[model samples]
Target: MLFELIKLGVDAFSSWNSNRSEIKKIKLENKKELVQLDHELKVAKAQSQIRMAEQDQAQTYNLDMQTTIDMAKTYKDEFILIIFYIPMIMAFIGYQDEVLKAFKSLDLMPDWYILIIVLLAVSISGMRGLFKQALELIGSKFNLKGK
Candidate 1:
């Protein structure tokens, strides 16, 4: 009877040891898998941060380009205003010369001729409105809102 009890105890001890070893192996494997998952999570977070930084840089660059474009538009508008005034000034000078010539050619200038000269002067100045409207039409067609 004592020998039988001893054998039974040995069998129980071997079973327990085997189960413990299996549990330890399973725990080690689970820990390794958890470590790998943590590494992957860290890598994904770093990649997300890099993408966000790149997006921010691109937005800043776009803002700078927009500002440059706005400044250039301002300069272009000033240049156009200068160009628009030049023709008006020349027309005024030419009308003065015509008036002087008319006065030299006649003892008394007729009212009709004086009225025609004044109308011509006014027409020359007002032609800028036609040019502005044409430009507006072209701008709208091309979607050139400039901003």
Candidate 2:
């Protein structure tokens, strides 16, 4: 009976030690993840600052960017540009799943409704300046107006 009890105790001790070792491994993995997350957060902050500086530089040089800049500085332009560029980027990057996930999370109004409201507030006639600028850009690109 004593020998059986000693064997059982040994088995329990071995199991407990294995569990402790596993816990230690998991804790080390969690600590590593925390360090990686801290580095990622720092990188994200640096990227945000760089993006803001780029927006400031663009505003200084680009007159067409003035409207979006004046309205909400970097944020408005960034939101619009994100909507425009992210899908384009994702298509090239092969991240269609992320785009679909974004689409699924949107609980907003339909596009046609937003279109009608925008047209009323910002008419096509109001875009003449933009149209002129685009024409000038194309003309300059083709050297249509004798440089």
TM-score for model 2?
A: 0.42
44-67, model 2: which lDDT tens digit per residue?
999999999888656544644555
Residue-level lDDT for 109 in candidate 2: 65
Query: Where in model 1 is the C-alpha error above 4 Å?
Result: 75-147
Task: List pairs with backbone clashes in candidate 2.
Answer: none
In order, candidate lDDTs are 0.70, 0.71
Predicted model with the maximum TM-score: 1
Q: Would you estimate the TM-scores of all the predictions?
A: 0.49, 0.42
TM-score of 1: 0.49
Q: Which 10-residue span in candidate 2 carries the lowest summed lDDT?
A: 119-128
Q: lDDT by residue for model 1 over 20-128, one digit each (tens)?
A: 9999999999999999999999999999999998896676566555655665645644554665576557658777665556557753778798667654443334343
Q: Report the poorest 10 consecutive residues by lDDT, candidate 1.
A: 121-130
RMSD of each: 19.9, 22.8
Q: Supply the global lDDT for candidate 2.
A: 0.71
